[model samples]
Target chain A: MRIGVVTFPGSLDDVDAQRAVRVAGGDPVALWHGDHDLQGVDAVVLPGGFSYGDYLRCGAIARFAPVMSEVVDAAHHGLPVLGICNGFQILCESHLLPGALVRNDHQRFVCRDQRLRIEDATSAWTGSYAAGQEIVVPLKNGEGGYVADEATLDALEGEGHVVARYLGGNPNGSLRDIAGIRNAAGNVVGLMPHPEHAVEDLCGPGTDGLGFFTSALRALVG
Target chain B: MARVVVDVMLKPEILDPQGKAVHGALPRLGFGGISDVRQGKRFELEVEGEVTEERLAEVRQIAETLLSNPVIEDYAVRVEQ
Candidate 1:
């Protein structure tokens, strides 16, 4: 399987996402922000970083990147897409997912190993994990708080669209401790944590995050 | 040419930590009785054509789509003399 990782001007984790794809036994393709083409990859990953210097808003300007047009189209067509950290902010900004990520409620940047419980493991990017499984991944960001209207939050919960929930504590004060969520079609996922950082045990807290990449591969190949 | 100003702000229900921080600091700096401080964004757009109903509508669309996220924000647009 081939996974495409897009690099925006300020993307800091595209390389790490590519490495994670390779670790999961998939070919990693490099896609550029200015390009509208997806390079024919089976899936796409929007890596974390302060795109466009986090100006205007986090992920606000990056959502207008040329590549995002293609990503939005492909994602709606059932192409598996995962957005991590700032990437998640972009996804929400692009309207691929509901809600918005505002500044951390504590008004500070936070970085630490965050524990997340798998709420729904049936999505394209989470199929490898068992329901209720807890995994620790690096969570780092200033604008990581998730917020939406009560109706939207209720809908997301009622439909079981929440993919992961913070286990130990709400690091960024996200509503209901929502760490990650999947689209209604289950093709797109947006999460605040940095899964790519936890793909290897030597460089990270553990190898628990490899499952996200592997799960995408399985969904594409199957 | 006319300059169009767009002010975007988070909805009242959403939490504004920056605004809260500013509100807290005002009293410490000897500015009292300031009940609230809501931080927001301002966009100045230059339009080459005359400001008409059509132009204002277009600017409104831009404000809704790009200048502010409707999910958590509210925006108002106006032409500046």
Candidate 2:
């Protein structure tokens, strides 16, 4: 399968995302923010970074990039999309997801191996793992706090859309320890931690993150 | 030309870490009795033409769709001279 990784002006993890995709047995396609085309890739990954310098709000400015229009439209049609860290911010800004990422409650940039529980393994990007499985990946960000209205939060929990939850401790003060979530169709997902960084044992926290890519591959084949 | 100012702020239900930090520092600097502080953003736009009801409505739309996230923030728009 072919997975496209979009590169915004300040995107720092697109390369890692691409490498992870390759390692997971999918071809990686490089996509540009300003490009109107998605290059007809089977899936897309919005990698992490301080896109557009995180101006006007993290992912706020980058959400207006030409590429996002296509990404948003494609995502609505059940095209699998995974957003990591700043990419999570972009998804929220684009209204593809239901929450906003605010400054961390600790008021500092945090980096660590974050433990996360796979709450819903049925999502397209998480099928490689068993439900309730716990994994650790690199979590790094300053504005990673996840916030949503109370009703929305309740609905997310009620509907089984909360894809992952923080296991050890809340890294960025995310509400209810929500580490990731999926859309109603389970095709789109946005998460705060950097799973791409953990796909290789030589660099990051083991290879626990390879499940995301491999899961997407399974979704495409099935 | 008309200048439009837009103020965007997090919704009351949302936590503001930056604002909280500022509020924490306030007590250290001799300020007291401050209940809370919420942080926000302000944008100033200078329109090239006359400001009309239509233009103001457009500005409101821009503020709603872009300047502030409806999920966690609220925004207000006004004309400034």
Candidate 3:
């Protein structure tokens, strides 16, 4: 399967994202932020980074990139999109997902391996795992807190859109211990963690992050 | 002319590390009496001319659909006298 990884200005993890796709045995394509076209890829990833220097709020400016227009369109048409870290911020900023990321409650950037339980593994990007399976991925960000109103939180829980939850102590004080979520359509996924960085065993962690890419590949071919 | 104040905050379910850190620091800073501190963003807009309620409404919509994320934060608006 062919997966497209978008690179916006200040996107620090695009190359790592593309490499992760390759490691998952899918063809990786590099997409530009200024281009609105998808280049006919089966899936897309918005890699992590401090886009637009995190000015005016993280992911706020990058959400307006031309590539998001295509990402939004493709996500609606059932194409899978996975956004990591700052990419998750962009996803929320673009309204692809339903929330925002704010500064860490600790007021400092937290970087470490975070344990997350696969809450809903049926989404296109998570189908490889069983619900409640635990995996560890790198989490690094100053603005990684997840928030929403009580009613919307109820809706997310009621609909089972919550994809991943913190397994250990809450890393960033995310409400309900939420670490990730998928869109209502189940095609788009966003998480404020660095899964790409953990895709290789040589990277000082387990390769559990590779499942996300492989899951997307299988979903695309299926 | 008219104006508005916009306030945005992280949802209760989401952790507020900034707030938590500040709360944690109260004891170290010798402010043990303080119990909690939550950090948020405040925006004030100075609107001109038309001064219609619709204009204020439009600004709020922009804040939600564009300016802020409804999932992670909530926004509040108040009209100027």
Best by DockQ: 2
Tens-place lDDT digits, model 3, residues A107-150: 77898988999999999989999998999988898888787777
DockQ of each: 0.85, 0.90, 0.51
- In the range B3-34, model 3's lDDT, one tens digit per residue, is 77788876676666668877887898787677
Instruction: Report the C-alpha lDDT of model 1 over A29-88, residue by residue, as the tens digit.
Output: 999999999999999999999899998888989999999999999998999999999899
Off by over 4 Å in 1: none
TM-scores vs. true structure, each candidate: 0.98, 0.97, 0.83
Chain B TM-score per candidate, please: 0.95, 0.93, 0.86
**Considering lDDT, where higher is better, how would the candidates rank from best to worst?**
1, 2, 3
**Candidates in descending TM-score order:** 1, 2, 3
How much is A212 displaced in model 3, in angstroms?
0.5
